[model samples]
Target: MTTCGDGRLTCDEETIDTIRERVLSDVSARAPFDAVTGNEDRVSDGAVSGDARATKTDREVAVSVTSLSKRFGDGADAVTAVDDVSFDAETGSIVGLLGPNGAGKTTLIKSVLGMVLPDEGTVEIRGIDVYDRPREAYTHVDAMLEGARNDYWRLTVRENLRYFATISGVDPDSVRDRHDRLLAQLGLAEKADVPVRDLSRGMKQKVSLASVLAGGATVVFLDEPTLGLDIESSRTLQRELRRLVEEEDLTVILSSHDMDVVETVCDRVLIMSAGKIIADDTVDSLLRETGLHCVQITSTDLDAQIVSTLRGQFDTFSANAREAGYQIEVTTDSDGLYALLALLRTSDVTLGRVRTVEPDLEDVFVDLTAGDRTPGER
Candidate 1:
């Protein structure tokens, strides 16, 4: 039960009553519960009461950002990191925050976490206004931001877990259970007694992830989690992340430059460039919208001359060769494919094989962000 900025009193108990009053007051209002109240007896008594459920489904938005903007400095020196970005993350889903380097993905994440103040607009976490109640609103969120990684070098892995759990006010018994589970899952069981300063980069990442999840917050934010990890460690992290989402019903907001990770992990994506969210949709939807795909061609004699000729024919052509043969990849339409084959034949370049590579979320991101170049771009 709480009161909003409008000074209207609302409670979980009187929610239905409030709805009823508002509905009856509207010209478009047609009470379906009329049969139960006997207001309209045109319906039969044996029929299901109008008090039956509403036809529309409930929309429970977990994260909502409206017209959010962030700027650094003043006047001509000011730089905008986020500009009027608006979107919502539905409950129990993973949303990816993606963009080119310096595209303001990190800025937006920090803004939502209350690390940086927005110049305009609102950020709401689980129905609580972050600007109005910073501490209270963030009580529902746990974020793993860059440069926030500070592990006690003197403490053992187990000791570090215990310390963070206590600081977060979680029960000791719960911490023990969670710590053990995370240790086994993250392959840190053997390193529990070892000092954190002795751990590898990948091991530190695992520990950080465990600590953030232990916060028991409904929403979790991860930034470039797989950036420095080897293939095996990255795979393990992805597997555990999927398990957490399915079993714990955790909602994740991921910011990463790894396209493969974003494609495989996220349900939806937000593409930003120059402080603005230019595109927002499901990963598959973005792929469909761009119609971007790739074609891979293998050749026996992939000489520099052949590569240069191919590059000239197709704007997106690239080639890689090894001891066996040369591999060429081109991104274009079907008609362009025919033109590519004709050029190869005319150039006398031997083709070993050809295959079409399905476009993933990364292709959509690159295609969209390529046109928007930022000053001092990375």
Candidate 2:
């Protein structure tokens, strides 16, 4: 295996070959693409022609985990990485898995993907038990871990896609149209024939994503998918993921430290802490339930005395000097907002501008995981 600069590991060519041989041996009797393309009556602009997106009622449970747990070492040195966690991901939706460092996010994901066996509980992919029927469970699943590491640097962009497709029990010729469409949708058509080693870091990341989808897998796991992308490239990739989920009925389990991306793209988020899920809800619901509000007040009258007074009263008080005046921000509840306003009025502080700051996913995450020491992982 090779390690990327970001400290994530990717499979080497020898490891890739081993995995391919194992998959081929296990799924030798699997049917071809024709047998999988049952939805031949629908069409979408970015998806294969005649492949309609599945409706909510028609969507099946793509992944399920029940009471999963994993631990490392023995006796007094035992460390639990995943603690009886359970969740289900439906087809045509993206579920975000988030946590701070050493929060068991990696171990939980590895257990779900069958890379590491859990000490307890079970995992099912497409209703097939992963441990009981590894071949069948993995047939509809694919993963792109550690950003751009999933692609072969020595191979051309198109060749990498075809190679992955072949390993997934697919015929490259059969998915030729799909590959073309993927390349076009990801802005990689121009680089299709170019070697991956010759592309920019961001382009290589996109190639990794395209190769993962080339196999036409129904369920995919992505780790830091937009690591090297610029703002525009990140937005483009987000749009493509939404399109794939809506048009091709793909299921995605996305794990990333970029809270902005998760907030924008995920249907639901699962937050882990200390080997346990601390929060699970839609982004909007989590924001609403936080009951935290931030207010920013700009005033030339915000002298050092007033700023110091406000800091003493509010735990989340912060002040920055602006061109025209001093801007002060305070995070409080609804009741505290009234108290703050009353204090300002009594201090004879004339506010030039008052704005309510919207709380985002990052704020919520930090609030939830505060005071937790970094632990776990053997």
- Clash counts for the predictions, in order: 2, 1
Q: List pairs with backbone clashes in candidate 2.
A: 42-50
TM-scores, each model vs. reference: 0.76, 0.80
Model 2, C-alpha of 75: deviation from truth (Å): 3.5
TM-score of 2: 0.80
lDDT of 2 by residue, 201-313 (tens): 99999999999988787889999999999999999999999988887788999999999999999999999988899998999999999888998899988888888888898
| Best-matching candidate per TM-score | 2
C-alpha lDDT of residue 44 in model 1: 28
Per lDDT, the best of the predicted structures is 2
Number of clashes found in candidate 2: 1
**How do the residues 1-378 of candidate 1 rate in per-residue lDDT, one tens digit apiece?**
788899997666367446534532441233322222233321221111243211223335778999998888899998888888998986667899887767888778888888888889998987889999776566557777752275665556876675554444343344466678878888889999887778888888777787677635567889877766789878888888888766555678998888888888888899999888988888888887786668898888677787887788665667887777688898865687778778788878777887989876756676688766675522
Candidate 1 wrong stretches, greater than 4 Å: 1-59, 299-303, 312-316, 322-325, 333-352, 375-378
